[model samples]
Target: MKLSKPLIIGIAGGSGSGKTSVTNSIYEVFKEHSVVVIEQDFYYKDQSHLDFEERLLTNYDHPLAFDNKLLISHLRKLLVRQSVEKPIYDYTLHTRSEKSVLIEPKDVIILEGILVLEDEALRNLMDIKLFVDTDADLRIIRRILRDINERGRSIESVVEQYLSVVRPMHNQFIEPTKRYADIIIPEGGHNEVAIDLMVTKIKTILENGTELYYDDDINQ
Candidate 1:
């Protein structure tokens, strides 16, 4: 089927702010059709050459940690109805996987990550930019849990990283980018009202061949 210009949506938030949850909610809504979600995490520069210990020391929360050039190129390709080989990242290994996921052109694309909003070229491509805001304490708690369960991090290491880099980088980069968001969804995906309004906007984009402007009164 002929697709309209792909609606590029970006979800940006600090680690553990439920960016994934909000992205997943949108994906679930469009899972039956031509919609694909790509993660900024997948674009982390390959660190396979570094030893595990050296990779561990890397400040991953910083913008320099990602291969934004590749991400931008892929997004441009997807925008032009071309397919892209999306990189697969290994969180456990702290490197890119040998294999990649081949993504076909879709009507909607969701990009989720901590630093996605920091790049002007990337943010320019997004038709809708969403910022997920959760309390710092809640975010820290979620980060600890995810690092432990999903990434095999020890409690001590999680806390150390949070203090040494994550929190500082979040304050320096992620938190400030909130002002750029077209919509700010407090409490992340738990805010059903916000999610519903986002869905409503997506449906409108699909129905009409145009993008919707961000309105301050969306969820109010």
Candidate 2:
């Protein structure tokens, strides 16, 4: 059944938190239906004007690093059931790629990012907000491995960046947004009980089109 309005779920967490795992869990359950995952990292500001060295100096974990105005516009279009050409970010170049992927409107839109809930406008657009609460040690370890293996970063560089930027930014920006979340998911995707309950809630909304409510128990 088609929803009267698409359900927008905002999943936010620290860089190494299992936000992707949580997003993928939800998407896998609804893959047969109309659902799409939009990553906030895909909206990083274009740095073509800057030289390679200058681009490398970018504080990626900061909120100002994103082109949220364009992201918000695109999200608005999707909310109206219009297609949008979503930007693709290039990690190697530290800027947005020229290529973009066209995304059609879906019944459920999962907006996942390190700071998806940081902006008031972005948070206002979400029907449900989730904060994945993973310990700092685990997060850093995961980040180091992911960056070295997937993003082609050196272990020394990853640790340096995490200590200098990621940790401070998380404390100042990302962690505070937890107060705005409808649910606080500890251990992220590893928490099977939370994921199962979240899936059930989404299915209920899709089937009934009922008003969404924040469950205090879910956060406990």
Score residue 172 of candidate 2 by CA lDDT: 97
In angstroms, give how far residue 143 of model 1 lies from its true place.
1.1
Q: How many Å off is the CA of 205 in candidate 2?
A: 0.6
Expressed as tens digits, the lDDT of each residue in 50-81 for candidate 2 is 99899989999999999999988888778778
Total backbone clashes of candidate 2, pairs 3 or more residues apart or in separate chains: 0
**Colliding residue pairs in candidate 2:** none
Using alpha carbons, what is the TM-score of model 2? 0.93
lDDT, candidate 2, at 50: 94
Could you tell me which 10 consecutive residues in candidate 1 have the lowest summed lDDT? 211-220
Q: How big is the positional error of residue 141 in model 1, measured in Å on the Cα after superposition?
A: 0.9
Per residue, candidate 1 scores C-alpha lDDT tens digits across 2-87 of 33478889999999999999999989998897789999999999998999989988899999999999998898788878899999
User: What's the residue-level lDDT of 71 in candidate 1?
Assistant: 96
lDDT of 1 at 108: 90
Which segments of candidate 1 are over 4 A away from where they belong?
A: 1-4, 210-220
